[model samples]
Target: VFRSEPPDDLSSEKDRVRVIVRVRPMNTREVDKGDRPILTCDTETSILVDGPQHSRRFTFDAVFDTNSAQ
Candidate 1:
């Protein structure tokens, strides 16, 4: 979430904004190991706002599965 205030020269009525959200695809990678195999995955969520003090937010999550957590 984000908030913005209009400039001193601008009035509140003239200030408006829009927001856009996107969930990007996850990335997976493989690793080589002599004892066991390792894998990793990550995903990201982005929030973009355009107009009147543009702002953005990004969040990311990561997980590792070793055949134990399915």
Candidate 2:
């Protein structure tokens, strides 16, 4: 499912396409294999990727997580 925010006012906003990021939930197969989720969306505008060696945060126009509604 996909969800979208209302468009911004063209008169006040810059002309640019929004960059959205969506993080899907782990599938049953992956869960069965004991794989854990590494991506997390703590806010509407950023995502965090947790890795073995390092963690990185990416900012975007919008971000959605596994629990986000359409």
Candidate 3:
């Protein structure tokens, strides 16, 4: 999770918070082991985790996938 300060003009909204999720790319080891990516970010604010048994969806204020820039 990441937090940011509102502008001085919006100091009264200090109580607000923002959530962010970043999905990292596969490493060399995982690639060598033939591991497949199970997480997908179809939208800018959501992530989908696909598992063998089931799938789950998560929402956030911002979502970054493997291809996102630093």
Candidate 4:
């Protein structure tokens, strides 16, 4: 949250306020080795920016969950 007020020296009577919020998925990395030789998986999210007084959200689901063969 951000708030701003016009300088006192200013003759105009105005004030400004801004708010921003963002949500994203955490990152995950996994490595495994098997008959395939080697395997690796990684997941990440990019940063998002919204206009003033805006909200953003992101969600993702895992297709498969397994233990590392290493």
Candidate 5:
């Protein structure tokens, strides 16, 4: 999530923006291809990055991988 500090004129806590992601599970055909997912995510820390050829890191609010169920 993102946080935005309020102006001094207003008395309030930091404003936040919540982010959520849902990754669909790979189907049978995709499994047969043996293709690998390019990105990996850490739900707890909201971090996503390329599995190979590390170039950059992306931070998120939350992430849901294929194994997760609604």
Candidate 6:
């Protein structure tokens, strides 16, 4: 009952899984207690920089900073 043949290349086009993150801004309570930004983001490379933990790099497909509205 098929009108057209299935895709010839059934294999997945991408071999890697992309990551995305949304960084929420600190609440009033956190600010009162001296809470700080632990993660810094790179929009160009979609990387997250964690300040609390040791130096490290996290790759992602997208990143939404606290100031992002869309």
Winner by TM-score: 3
List all candidate RMSDs to the true structure. 13.5, 7.3, 6.8, 16.7, 5.9, 11.2
The CA lDDT at 8 in model 5 is 52
Stretches > 4 Å off in candidate 6 = 1-11, 14-18, 51-53
**Please, what are the lDDT tens digits per residue for candidate 1 over residues 1-70?**
4333324564455464333233333335322322322212222223333334654433222222233333
TM-score of each: 0.21, 0.73, 0.74, 0.19, 0.53, 0.60
The residue pairs in collision within model 4 are none
Model 2 off-target regions past 4 Å? 1-14
lDDT comparing candidate 2 with the true structure: 0.79
Clashes of each: 0, 0, 0, 0, 0, 0
Worst 10 residues of 5 by lDDT: 2-11
Give a tens-digit lDDT track for model 6, residues 1-70: 4212234655564865555578788889999999787777766445445655564566555778888775
Point out the higher-scoring one by TM-score: 3 or 6: 3
**Which one wins by lDDT: 1 or 5?**
5
Candidate 5 positional error at 33, Å? 1.5
- lDDT minimum window of 10 residues, candidate 6: 1-10
lDDT of each: 0.33, 0.79, 0.79, 0.29, 0.59, 0.63
Candidate 3, clashing residue pairs?
none
Ranking by TM-score: 3, 2, 6, 5, 1, 4
lDDT of 4: 0.29
lDDT by residue (1-70, candidate 4, tens digit) is 3222223564433553322223322334322322221212233322223435863432222212224221
**Which residue pairs show backbone clashes in model 6?**
none
The runs of at least 3 residues in candidate 5 whose Cα sits more than 4 Å from the true structure, single-residue gaps closed, are 1-16
In model 3, how large is the Cα lDDT of residue 5? 29
